[model samples]
Target: MASYASKQLLSIAIIFFCALGHLTSAQIVTLEVKEGNSTCIKAELVARFSVAYNTTNGTRTVTFPFPGNATVGNRSSCGGTELPPLLAASFGDGHALILRFSINGSQYRVESLALEYNLNDSSIFPNSSSPSLVTVKTDSAGILAQINTTYRCESSWPVSLGGGSGNASGNASVTFSNMRLQAYMLGSDLSRNETVCTADQSVTTVAPKTSPVTPAPVPTVPGNPERGNYNVTNNNGTICLMAYMGLQLNLTYPSSVQNKTVQEVVNLQPNQTKSSGSCEVSNATLQLRDDRTNLTFSFTLNTTSNKYHLSGISITATWPDMKEPFSASNGSLDYLRGTLGRSYLCSAEQTLVVDQTFAINTFHLQVQPFGVNGGQFEAAEECQLDEDNMLIPIIVGAALAGLVLIVLIAYLIGRKRSHAGYQTI
Candidate 1:
């Protein structure tokens, strides 16, 4: 009977330990940010103090909150309570990913993950298995830099079917009406060369047993005059991609010009046009991908007047992303130097809210960049500054001036007629 009791006690103790062990083996998810190229970034998530193969779906569901107080925006797949779809997909991958995160409010589709784990854990038990930690790292610096330095222009490209994947090309002329146009042309060069060729004996009527006849050298096509690539610099540090409303992308190229020249010419333009020549691109979108942000933009560009208007730009990025959209305006004016400056006037702070149907996590961003340059009114093009409210002040000023002029004219005419009547009487 005593022996039976001892066995029962031992079994209960074993069960208790098993339950305790499971609880103690739970893993914690943590993340780190690493830097990368301007276009993309690397984000790292580390599952710490974990037992092998013990960290799965349930364990991962724990929210690893990021400290960046980004404006939590839209993520279409699930409700705002759950992980955004793109972040979920990127994180759901077997390995840790250096994926797009969010900045302020933006979203992206997560793609690949590279994960690592340590394999040494024996402190808890005398004969226990070794434990490892899973770490993920990505580039936040790269993302911020990309946002700061990058350029954006949207155009519809004409699509062609002759190529395997099909080809698309278009050129929408972008006129920098108010913007300064500075150009430099490189001189074209030409050279001559001589070569010899041997004729086939079968084709030539060779004297019986004579050597093969030498053929005239073929002429080489001369290299066409090519333009050098231009470099655009913001002399005042205020010029930005979003400032111009009359901006259109030019992609068409003349057949005679070499492709190198074509690249050089457009490369020098104030805003780089994505594709080249007479072809115009419509229904185009802008995509900004990086470790901290994945931003997708959809907008329109007018064909005839070379005007660009942004419809909307949406983004899908990391979870816990947040922002309050705000608008501010500041301009520069140098009377002595005649240097025009710009200012920014943004709308009141508004949170970004995304519809939850696209099945992908996304964030959002919007800007016009008029304030970045000094004077919206004095910009080269009339519509370069597109503030609906700015027109009100101008209308009121015109009305007030007209009213003053009418009152003065009535006074002057009444006085003149009275003086004339008195003289006549």
Candidate 2:
């Protein structure tokens, strides 16, 4: 009975020591932030870790609390909290124990922030079994902490076991990790109004072609030149003007030349007029040139509501040594009528000349540097029949003369025949 009691006491002692050893081996893992040398008050702290163990083995688990606050900018302000319940394992390894936390919103600048956590192990073991070695090292290979900020700061630590193991017993170990902190200042304003002006100016010259004119009979007027009489001269000249985008201008001509009255005509070339959409020229000015006229124009951009006012348009005609200036004018600016686009005015003068018979002459004018932006100029002269139909009157007179001659001849012949037939009656 005495031997059995001694043996039972020894067995009790062995069991108590084994349990104590296991308790000592279990470890509490922790992460901490160290303050760095910086005066700015801005920093962020982040921590990540994983816990793994065997499930089938005699492994047990425990729940632990994570740290929240860290020292920043010489003050304890920035902090984080555990998202989920902290878990540990003893014997069997199953799913990974993932720990993730972040610390921010601390306006104060700090040198660095620290992190700390606990990892515990509880597992049953066979008698005289070797102690299991468990390690709590940085999850990422050779990387413990990462600091990403405007300032160049970092964390430092070596990977190793948190605590020593006990023979067939459980233990709790504490692990330490740290990161350095740095801070910076930030700032931001609005914009003003302005105006601008632009212009496009150009000049061009033109020479026109002429066609032969058919002559028509002239009417007799005692005191005036034959109404429809015109003599063709070799002095035919022409000028051609073309404006792709169109243009606006004003022209004037002399009312009379050398005491002879003159006439002016305005006509659009046949099949040459073109328009697109609702675009058309309105309120246009047309006149005969007797004196100088001024021309002004306002150009508008198609894509935007912008206008450009241009003036000082001068036209001069040069023939050998003769140079004559013509007058031009422009319309008032219409801010509201932006779609009017372009307009034009053209005029010419004519005079009657008497040498032996009557001849009509026209004053020649040339537009110097005759074109503007996308604009062209053309001029030509040809002998054309007068508006009056003098050819019809001439034909009627000839027919009447032929008829009168035939009647006279017939009367003479009839008188002769009667005299011959009467004999001495």
Candidate 3:
């Protein structure tokens, strides 16, 4: 009886700890991508939804709880080397969500995302047909980032798909939030590594000193730039590079064009037209310009080994007192090195010093340097910063495992000693 009691206690302890661990982890569901009978990608996702529907007198909104156990249905276009890979999921009661992806050259993007919920199935809309649900595509919540990278950010931002159509028409008024996704996994099992996003970076939000009522002095160091997804596509609708960063350029140009040097800051961002960057099989470019400055970043593709990197940078600037715009070029620097169809990630700030004249800093940066395939980030090369960030969890997990092992060993020895004094009577 004593031995049996000890064994039972050991089992109970293990179960209790496991349950506690599960409760502490994020509420996410697992998804698998099968490629030719092999499970190529495994992911965990957490999605929540808010939807609007018609009523007898007016309209109403319903917010859904954390989506649990949503499965990718048969119509999903996974396991292909195609332009886009899609995941379609249908929850119970005719509620569904679909995610579309685009991969080109060196980047991947969320092409489209839609949420569907049947008004008839929802208890709030009692007198509706079974197929009365509408679908809404989010116009702004598209996540543009690298291919084959782990994306992590705890967001409460509401991403509206649309349907404010205001017409009594059966259009979807849908939104989603608290989205956590790890997709295009390199191995069958999902990895816990995460690439930092620009949204998670510190912003330069120092309000300008204006009113006399303001007491504190304004800060001199600028905060982070607004990070966003920037891409370029070819005339053939093929992608070249997909970059995500809050990009800022620092130039130490001669203040008088004769030799007195000082700092000049330029921001690189997407424009209204041709906002999607440009790409080719051999190389890609991201460009932004102002009235006096033109800046371009060039990435080179390695076809033989199927890899790519940020290889070159060029700028044209016309400062005051200078008659002609000065030109600067730097090539053969490997910044974000990554495999084709994969991404490169750096959580910490990165600086590329082209020369004393100019330097580039990228924050909250995750990029698919080249060779995006199947509209999915399937593999990744982590920057030293991200790798180091990932290591912390690993080290902590190892310590926890060691502690568990020690307790297990102690229990085993106790059980063995108890058994020594008795036989299988």
Candidate 4:
């Protein structure tokens, strides 16, 4: 009878250990639903349920159906309570689940189970490569209170959420519904934990316009005319004249007469013949003309003191059409006395005249020939001469003429008287 009692106690202990293992074992609950092609949603719950029995009573079996269209698989064990098979389901929005269980002749019921799901993955998260978190919450009567979770993979695996506009190559979405999850009672509520995964995508491109540039205007400048005049005296006393327009100049001998020197002291009758060397030319004039400009000069000869043998020449010029001032300069004077050619000489003393003329719009002188010395000449309206010293030669000539006339009359009267005294012998 003692061996029989020992065997009964050992069998009871074995049954209690089996029931404890069933209550402590874990089960998996999966849910899958769809929203559209652009999003993906999934959820899972790992849970264990337990039932308590009175110590005096023997073991009891409890069977329950999972809520909604959930199905069961993969049974497990726990401590002092038995865990039912795993439950899972899939449906559209707004689905419900109810869990019913009978433990030790007492019934426990949880009703009106609904899941509130949210996916926060959009174009707002620009730099995030990972999918957004999925949140699932149950009403007060459900076994799981709330779950913030993620899934391993999503249909829209890689997505670019950025600022621009273009179409995505492939678009897909995921969802979750009617997932039966089990949990133990803590105070007055039942709860489970889970994670769901999702993703987002976008593309954008743009083309910009360009602008044109404008060019700056070119500037205009007025042209300047070339102008200058020069005079040269050779060894034979002939004068050379040169005048310029633009870069061109007419180089010619204006005077071919050799200059004569005046004697320092001379007494002669009014009509007396004097050698050319004893008299010099004076009161000379030069006139130069062109279509746009005119130049004139009056000169005198001084054989004794003038180095150029010509002096007292004053220059004047006028430009009828030009509003600007005309300028000229005598740039050089080279006296090549012994090197002069024969054509530069003159045969006799005579008056020098020059009437060089042209017609042109622009004139500028670049070079002046050598063998002459003078000041620069500029275009002007009038030039005055010193005529006060010109009367000395005139007065001297009158006095000499009067003296010769008186002498001639006295000689004639004396000759007549002498003849009368001879009495026609």
State the C-alpha lDDT per candidate.
Answer: 0.24, 0.24, 0.57, 0.25
Name the lDDT value of residue 395 in candidate 3.
Answer: 58
| Alpha carbon lDDT at 255, candidate 1 | 25
Give per-residue CA lDDT, model 2, range 99-118, as digits (tens).
22232332112211222222
- Candidate 3 vs candidate 4, TM-score winner: 3
Per-residue CA lDDT of model 1 for 35-89, tens digit only, reads 1211122222222211112232311111121222221122212212343222221
Error of 3 at 397 (Å): 2.0
C-alpha positional error of residue 13 in candidate 1 after TM-score superposition, expressed in Å? 99
Clashes of each: 70, 79, 18, 37
Question: In model 2, how large is the Cα lDDT of residue 410?
Answer: 53
The CA-based lDDT of model 4 is what?
Answer: 0.25
Q: Write the per-residue lDDT of candidate 3 for residues 1-425, one digit (tens) a residue.
A: 45675776678668766865664344666666576675543445555454545566555545554456677777676546544577777777776677776655534455666776666674545544333556666433435433455554443233335432222333232322234454565676544444433233223453322223222222233566668776666687666566677777666544454444345555555452134357767888887666666778888877965656677788787867544567777774545656677887766666564543466667788777466655445566665445434544875676578657766776777778778788776
lDDT of 4 by residue, 161-265 (tens): 111111211111112222333232222222222211111000112111111110111112123322333343344655533223221221111122322211010
Candidate order, lDDT descending: 3, 4, 2, 1
Q: What RMSD, rounded to one decimal, does every model reach? A: 34.1, 52.0, 20.6, 64.8
